[model samples]
Target: MFLKLLSYPRSLIGVIIFIFLTAASAGSLVIVNILFNNRKIEDHIVEFWTRNSCRLFGVNVVVKGLENRPEGGFLYVFNHTSFFDIFAMNGWLGSFRFGAKIELFKIPVFGAGMRRAGILPIARSRREEVFKVYQAAEARIKAGERFALAPEGTRQEVESLGPFKSGPFVFAINAKAPIVPVIVKGAAAILPKGHYIPNWGVWKRTITLEVLPAVDTTPYTIDQRPLLQEKVRQIMAPYFHGDDF
Candidate 1:
């Protein structure tokens, strides 16, 4: 009975406050990133923004499988569902970089800020440009920085999963970094894809982050990326449908 009333103006108010706060704060960070070019500041700002956005939007996060994570540089891979996945990750996984779409980099200040923050811009439209993204990611891994990327490449609608891409695995093997598989559930309920505004109907919705064991790339060569990719997918299959992994 109480939730019904919260759904009316409360949801609308939540979305409006979320947009204003995120833009105002993130816009400042973007400009700072572009000017300073400091990775530390970039990470701190991203962590603050991602976590706080979830809070302001009334999204709760539940994290599991942290014991499976290693204490060194790794390639963190996950299934993409909604934009909230980004928040759930950075909010949980500490400091890490990302491989974002090139279009994001073209956004006036936001794009440039992402670049300064060590986010690799992936030009999926250009075949040759893909290698450039891989090269950049490899260097970051070699430098001992964790990177979070989605093998699915883009966000999918609720109750749906997209095909995974193997390029990130190949890059992982080349960098000799461990592959960390993560399964994020319930983001779609908080904020569905293609929706400009978020739903605060229940005041709070839990987004689960399942961090699976890392797949070591030491024994595998670049040529065997597909085999490694398939292994991780199988490990993540049950988790995707809300079953135990």
Candidate 2:
């Protein structure tokens, strides 16, 4: 009974901290957006927020593999395991927009901030919405904006990646951009789905953001979609499931 009673205050405190951090970060983003016309400057704001989040949650991010970003436009694909994946990626990657859910655009400050920051939102259930989102992403790439997407569609608690969604590949094909596979580890254990509070422990967590060599889809025709998808899947398998790809 006592343990259960103590849970309320703990949850409340966590909620308060979340709100405070969110507001502080949002305010900083707004200021940066207004003051800096450069996209790189805006990206730094996001990186700052992510780093702050890691500190606030006591997350230790240890990146591995190639960190060099390609010189031109590319579709970045990564494994999704937790919401913290956003922070982990944003902290490492620079000058890229995100492909996110449309519902996130309705979340007051966060939604407005994301839209302003060039994040493309889509309704996962609606095919038309998906197309619209892809079009926007393609346009952004044409305009010289790099973008990141999670082909897993949603977070999978297991180490193995879920089936690759065609949406990201479609964007890559349309934009004629190389597909860069990114792998992240240890986010799920820090904060899993359906859990509001992170499991705050002293153990150090390793978060890798590997930028694999870009995959070229130029030679493959539209009819060879399956081959293209399988190739990306194979390249990502090792990092997704902790094996050597």
Candidate 3:
């Protein structure tokens, strides 16, 4: 019925509207950040925006294994899918900040807001600037603040799990924080690649967040990041159906 109601042209038009709505919400986030100058409030704003977006898009999120999340100082890892993946995670997952590529932190109001929203800028190498960011992350981790990461480094529309990056695992081990591997199913329908997760054909769909048991990072050493990364990937692979665009 939805397919009958939404033609290809309409879906394309809908995507524009979707992008506009996202932009407006993000602009509002920037305003909130500037006015409040508070990380906690900024967090609330981001969560609120993400929730409203799902509602607007007629997307439903079912979070399974939420109980597996440990209290404090956890590094959550996920399988990257759609652009909506970020929103879906924030809406269902906690208001924990995300660790993103450094280049994303350079994009105008989006970047500024992200900084106040406490999104950690993860760099490939240790330049002085990235070094300082790492220093801050270590302090925050020790202080019991939580964070999330997509180990695939970037989102792609694919049928299988991408290679997991070792950086986040290293970060987790460095902080002695537990790693919560999550399988996010059904996000690729929201936006694919080239055209967007999967042709933007889905208006209403259920996105599931299956949070697996947290892998204890305390025993992993810095040099063992690759081993730890593979271990976490193995744990999540079975549950990740990829449900891609």
Best by TM-score: 1
Candidate 2's C-alpha runs over 4 A off are: 1-15, 31-36, 201-203, 240-245
Give the candidates in order of TM-score, highest first.
1, 2, 3
Model 1 CA lDDT for position 157 = 77
- Candidate 1, residues 94-204, lDDT tens digits: the string is 788878889988776666657667787888777578777887678778888899888877888764557778778888988999999988988988778787666545666
lDDT of each: 0.79, 0.76, 0.75
Query: Which residue ranges in model 3 land beyond 4 Å of their true spot?
Result: 1-3, 7-24, 123-132, 197-199, 241-245
**Number of the top-ranking candidate, with lDDT as the measure:** 1
Model 3, span 1-245: residue lDDT tens:
66735645555565577667666666777787778776677677788778876776667889999899898888888888776678889988876888777888787767776776778887756546544665669778888888888887777666358877666776788788999988888877666644442334444677888889999988889888878887887787776465221
lDDT of 2 at 113: 77
Model 2 C-alpha lDDT per residue in residues 1-245, reported as the tens digit of each score: 65455545654565577777776666666667778756777777788877767665556776665544667788889888887888888876766888888898888788777877878887899978888779867766866778889998887866568888787887788888888888887788777877667544333456667778889977766667778888999988965545443
Q: State the lDDT at 159 in candidate 2.
A: 57
Q: Report the Cα lDDT for candidate 3.
A: 0.75
TM-score of each: 0.90, 0.86, 0.84
